[model samples]
Target: MRAFHVTFEPFSGGCGCGRRGAAVRGADGRTDALRLRAAATAHVACQVTKPNGSTHTRMGIKKLIIFLLVLSLCLEGGSAKEKGTKKGKKKGKQVYCPSQLSSEDLARVPANSTSNILNRLLISYDPRIRPNFKGIPVEDRVNIFINSFGSIQETTMDYRVNIFLRQRWNDPRLKLPQDFKSDSLTVDPKMFKCLWKPDLFFANEKSANFHDVTQENILLFIFRNGDVLISMRLSITLSCPLDLTLFPMDTQRCKMQLESFGYTTDDLQFMWQTGDPVQMDAIALPQFDIRQEDIDYGNCTKYYEGTGYYTCVEVIFTLRRQVGFYMMGVYAPTLLIVVLSWLSFWINPDASAARVPLV
Candidate 1:
């Protein structure tokens, strides 16, 4: 028998001839190539299909993962944006409206302790009573400039206020009794008196704008008899210094300082009725004596008076305005007599002689 052809062919799924082959044994102990080739072809086809399928699956999974990551980032960003918008609205609301303090709240503040030094108090005429004069006349308004100097001494603060008055005048309403009049009016300085109400008393921190200072309540009063007085009641809250004993020990110095404030009203014009119309008169300053006192410094229940603590300065200043007289002598009558004599000299001599003879 012809030797059983035993041949094995190297499988090339592509059609080709002269391909290298390998020998295989048949089931009947003979070489069989067909079955072997068929099996190899099937294995190659399965391997190719498996790899392609696995590649497609992996790419799909990757795309799904990237999409999920992008969506999660977008959600987080949107949440942060919403939170920021809420915060902005809250700040905007607070900017337009602010809380206010009630009148009862202001009443809770304590009064200054310096209210009692001089017992004789002179108050200004109530503005309500003088409704016509509710606003100060521009000519009568006094411009005062006050400068304060202070030093810290043992247990007290030594402070002084320098005062200067400009264009000072007495109220035109002051009148003298008929019995007090003299041929030459001798206006005594001691007979006049005055009092000034400081502007600090009516300050309300809540209603007042933080930067405003023009809303101060201040007044000046004068007596017919030359005496000047000042009354100031101020309530102030302060933070105590670290060293309390460095305050000044002398109370008199403090009083002097409080009285040192001065004013400028020189340009002020005084008005008087001249028979028919108002006329402007130059106002003269009065000479007066000044006395100062610091009555109470709040409550001594906690500490000694004039200590380095939050307290007020109640000051009383007694002052006087002096008045002098202007003498109008017989000059006007003398001039008239001289004028008549000159006219008589100019008269015709004959006419004058005839008139004299008839008399």
Candidate 2:
């Protein structure tokens, strides 16, 4: 069945009808606004869903960053603690000065090490002051040679060795003098001791009574700490008793035997009164000056038998300290004299009367 359609005709500018139309238009506009509002609501729901998804990811990243920060702090704290602990512990290595070494400590060094110490401590021998046996006069040449040879060859004589302790009272705080005198160091016998071996006699074919006058076969030791020790052995051949003979003749028999035969000890002892000791610094043998005189037996005998030999052995052990002084006393003056002579040549010959005289 077809329903009857109601159709409204437009009235001409009438108030009631126009107002109804206006209201209808207004209603349509309101419907459009509602649709727009629905669309905006849907967009807002999609935006909220996306933001929720991203919120979890952002929160997880923040937690990871915080954890890393805490872990770094813990590791840093542990490293700092380890460093502090290390610094608190003591180190194992140590250093020592020469003065720090006590007597006991010095004793621990081997003999070879002690020798090295002495080599470093002592001064070397001077070449200029070396004894010139050849320069001796012709008259004294034979005696000098005999004395030298006897000193080197003889094994025994008045064998005496001494060890002296030298100590100076200078202020340690003050600088040492330019010309420091070693003699200024006092000799303290109580600080050192010595050992000696005596000479013995025997008979030989060349000599009626032979005796050793010098301890040539002896070995002397001077430690770096100034201790001295000596070892000596002697032998001689003599038909007669050496004790009965006169001064020079008695020494000849001893000299011949000492030059010919001897035995020596390999080791020696050096002790100190200070009770504390170090190694030997230097060693030197004593020197001897010997003189000989020919004696005539009253009988007219042409042979050497009737012509007895008189020999004298003068042993002088100018201690090592004294030897150094002797060298200095001789060489220092000579060097000064040479320097003065050279300077004199540089002086103007016309400058002064002294210059002319010197020239």
Give per-residue CA lDDT, model 2, range 191-307, as digits (tens): 112211222222222333223344223344443223333333323222222342332222332322111012111111111223222122233333323223321111111113443
Taking the tens digit of each residue's C-alpha lDDT, what string does model 1 give over 222-275?
Answer: 343422222222222211122323222112222211111111112122221123
Can you tell me which runs of candidate 2 are displaced by over 4 Å? 1-200, 203-322, 356-359
lDDT by candidate, in order shown:
0.31, 0.31
Name model 1 segments beyond 4 Å from true: 1-149, 152-172, 182-359
TM agreement with the true structure for every prediction: 0.16, 0.16
Residue 190 CA error for candidate 1 (Å)? 16
Model 1 residue 132 CA deviation (Å) reads 5.0
